[model samples]
Target: MTEMEWEGEFDPMSDPEEQRHLLSVLDSFRSYRRLAHFNGTHVRRQAFYSLPQEHWTLLSKPPFSVLDSFSKLDDLIDCNAELAEAIFKAGFRAFLAPTLDSDWVASVVPKKYADDDFRTYSIIMDNMKVQTSQNDMEKARSCINQFYREWSAEGAVERSKCFEPVLVALQHEFDMRKEADPGLDRSAVHVLAPGAGLGRLVFDICRAGFSVEGNEISYHELMASSLILNHTENVGQFKIAPFALSCSNHLSRTDQFQEFQIPDVHPSSELADAIGSKVPAHERMSMATGDFCVLYSQHEHKHEFDAVATVFFIDTAPNVIRYIETVRNCLKPDGIWINLGPLLWHHISRKEDDEREDKSRGRRDVVDAGISDPGSVELTNNEVIALVEHLGFVIITQKFNAFESGYMSNPRSMLQSSYRPAFWIARRKPSSS
Candidate 1:
């Protein structure tokens, strides 16, 4: 999925709503930027290195000129000059130290700005005064309110690393299948995507003219995805800036601020046209929320789907063998299974209490297989392939790809992740009976 290119310039003076939204965003960002400057100077001695690396690499190099976008604002104060003066006028004021106060703002800020010393006060005010296109200033203000948009459907980082590869693979498999079988019904081809985050893949598949469904387990995510896919209209271009690491040394909680957006997914012309031309997205694609393993066991779905695409799923279960079995049973004879993700085992343990809890929650199939442990069973790539073949699957294509992937990881930490995700397309072996 190609990101929507930045279109016409943002005219803040033209629209009052847009103007209000822009100022509000700028206000918040100024506070955040000031906080970063403070940490860069006092707290994090290596802030230049320790800060979150910019994901959206700008074309223009550093020493960026002031954006013409914000030049309209008449009252402006240079932050650099004020910051230098603050360094000179240092001992005059005490920074407002965070406290164990009840009024915690966003769980990151422990104290109110009202209690800060002169140094902290000056920095905040200076940030509010300075306006430039340097850093993420232009992109940030351009797409003001969209910072919290879902990454699966909108963010740049996820689109490049996750969605793009999956889309290409799906197209490759479809083309191959159609070539091998001239009678293949392209329009009627049905694919099931388990653990579809925000329905981006499913939506894109539908955009490519296929029948698709997405299955998710998290209620909150399911609802959110539904609202975004079905209710929202014509919002596409968004950005993701993971700059929350400056708030705290150790990331204690999920950083919601990191995923903020501009507007929201500005779908490519192809995607937009497909979505606009087809039956409403909500009607064209289906989203089911529940355990995917239990989905096939519901009696009527055996060997039902034409294809099963699992991206970043599979390892969610304690027994991935069960997932293989489920896929085998769910796919029609010679039906394909496309999987792409690391074997990052999610199940930590199968303690008696955990087993009881699983059963109570209707996960009766979670039985101990007498492996190394109940839940910590991890299989190598070769072992997984062997097990798939044993279950009567013929590997069509297989590949090992390493991609940078981090699920809202701390932007300040040197901790980067690379998932050596294995991609495989296997077909159910025809029954000999």
Candidate 2:
């Protein structure tokens, strides 16, 4: 999932209030251009990487709340220019307030984290502002790299990774869906994660009783993901070789990479002996390597699996259409689709309507250009739904947590996303039903 795609799978909710929240998100988030804002107080250091602004506003939407605590900053800032400062400020206050007193803000900040939470939060904050003077698009890349570095240094290899928070959200949604409909063929459900990073989510998917297949562009991420899967009881390792290491430096967590310095046998006799003692063979982990988009034949195996999913992926794809279509092609006619992520289209086009339209400004351009480029491809709320419907998927439930301040600790966190918390669960359009 690239800039135009919605990769992360969202947990489903059947509550009318939740559904209303989803629709509200769709309505409010339609135009996110204004959402990409700078902290004027930081002057040259604008963007999410700059200094925090307690007086700043996260967005113009609903769920307004001040980010007074660090726990609130993640929910506060969207992936925008103003995120860094908000998180840093909120985190500093959250974990070290008593020490700072009135003189704290005036003194040079300490290098070490007071605790793990503050460390994670601080890393996220410091990394966000690493950009010296690059455009927003480039800052996105820079900040992402910075965030990963700090996250990994804090021992994200096995914990506190984006994988866990995203997966926890995914698991919650998955369980809710299962409870809502027990007839979806619980056994042997297949999972597809196109850009499966470290593969933690894949592990979770497999652990949830669904067989998972992943397509990562790099050998490094694939290897890291593979190591995790291999050691796990029920999972699989699928990749296209040479885990993309160029992007490795951008990612801060390297503990897993350090562990899997050598790729081992997939379900090898050695691995078998290691795992057979615990998990059964039938549920043993599996892995593959290849372009996931090329799995047309795998998709042709009709009724072979129940569903396909992506996480924090679709929104990053350069071609959102191809991404969605790819998932559609893989899923059984009656399978379900889920995603979780901020609708990041506004950063691309600064226009909500672009998201629904066949807007293809070029995904690579996003990586090259800064986040402020107006020529990006983004869709409006109506467009996202239309696009999903066009893909022949029926939305069964949706939830919008765009307004939830628990997401970040920024002034924007106080502002509501027009459609953040924009989560939806859908089923393939049954031909007869």
Candidate 3:
């Protein structure tokens, strides 16, 4: 065994290369941070399984186009080898941890570029996109920006991280929806991904035949996602719309999601351009943003959607109670709520325990934001379950053992990295009151 194994978890810290692998993953984010609106707030911490197996129904077919099928699926996928090859270039190897070993990585990756195994989409394509350092982020931004500039493209579609599990969850939801309502328009599904940094998760859903809209609060990040998604759907013969893009919680246009490489819509009149984008006449897509809590009811869109998903989202919102309430308001009583990712104590580290570690690293801004809300405060898994149950919904299924699911990538490449995702596929308890 690699020196990286531990008793309760997969341990990679013991290996000589452990530091290199972990450092590589950590460094990836810096690159994104420089060009992105992310404030070094949260790190992924652990790895999760993603792609074809977990969310098969989505990658099964294309979801979007500027208007129609101008690009053939065969054409875009033909470059799959090129895309896969680009991943291992230079420092990206850090994404693979020391514990992974040659055999595992080889299994997940195509044996040879021309190998028949490469003919299979799932065998070749894996969304292993993870965090890197600022310099890498800068390089990525520069390259992406240049790609857009040269191609006269608008944006690249960002797909959700940990793709396989997301797909699995999506497949389960799709089956349930069909069973629940036979006449339902399968395509009427519209997903709202808040804090859609780089549009990863949003695009994954979009690839599933659902209409998606990402509500981003950060400006540059929005620009990056918008640029990639917009341009990808435009120039590529395999053009596909990632999702409906927009930024809310933003009072000013400049302050919303905009990545470094992308240029303003009109450059001179950003606010006017945003207004124009919303005009319905000039827009290539649709979008809106508001507090998810009471947002549906406030907007009079109560019981509007068939499903409202939160992937690595609930952790960001400390108020699970209000968050669920808001999600409940939007979902039809019989609608499904597929909640994934950790209910992390992160997004808000405990401020009261200042004496436990460093006091200078105090988080006054977030604490003041809502650190006072008892329900919003971080709690244990048991606490999460009690709260969700009290909210009057039933937990359907959760796969906390994704690490054991046997994906080709060993999640614990760095330290004891592994993921535990929970789901509460619930229906609103019929109100007797």
Please tell me which predicted candidate would have the highest lDDT against the true structure.
1
TM-score of each: 0.55, 0.41, 0.45
Segments in model 2 whose C-alpha atoms lie over 4 Å from true places: 1-187, 227-284, 296-304, 345-377, 402-421
Q: What ranking emerges by lDDT with the best candidate at the front?
A: 1, 3, 2
lDDT of 2 by residue, 1-433 (tens): 0011112122112333322332222212111112322221122223433435543456212343322221222222233223233323332332234333344333434445445543443343343332222233332223323323222322244233334444454455456666878654333445666666655455455444555666564222432343333332222221111111121232221211221112122333333344212343234334444334434324363444455556556666554665566667667776777766556642454334333221322123223222222343577546776888877888876666633322211111223323234556677887611
Q: All models: lDDT?
A: 0.51, 0.40, 0.41
* Residue 337 alpha-carbon offset, candidate 2, angstroms: 0.2
> Which rank order by TM-score, best down to worst?
1, 3, 2
lDDT tens digits by residue: candidate 1, 205-294: 777766777876532234334434543444532233343333345333233133443225533333546733234333346666556766
Candidate 1 vs candidate 2, TM-score winner: 1
For model 1, what is the error of residue 242's alpha carbon versus the real structure, in angstroms, after optimal superposition? 5.2
Q: Model 3 segments beyond 4 Å from truth?
A: 1-161, 179-183, 232-286, 294-299, 350-376, 404-416
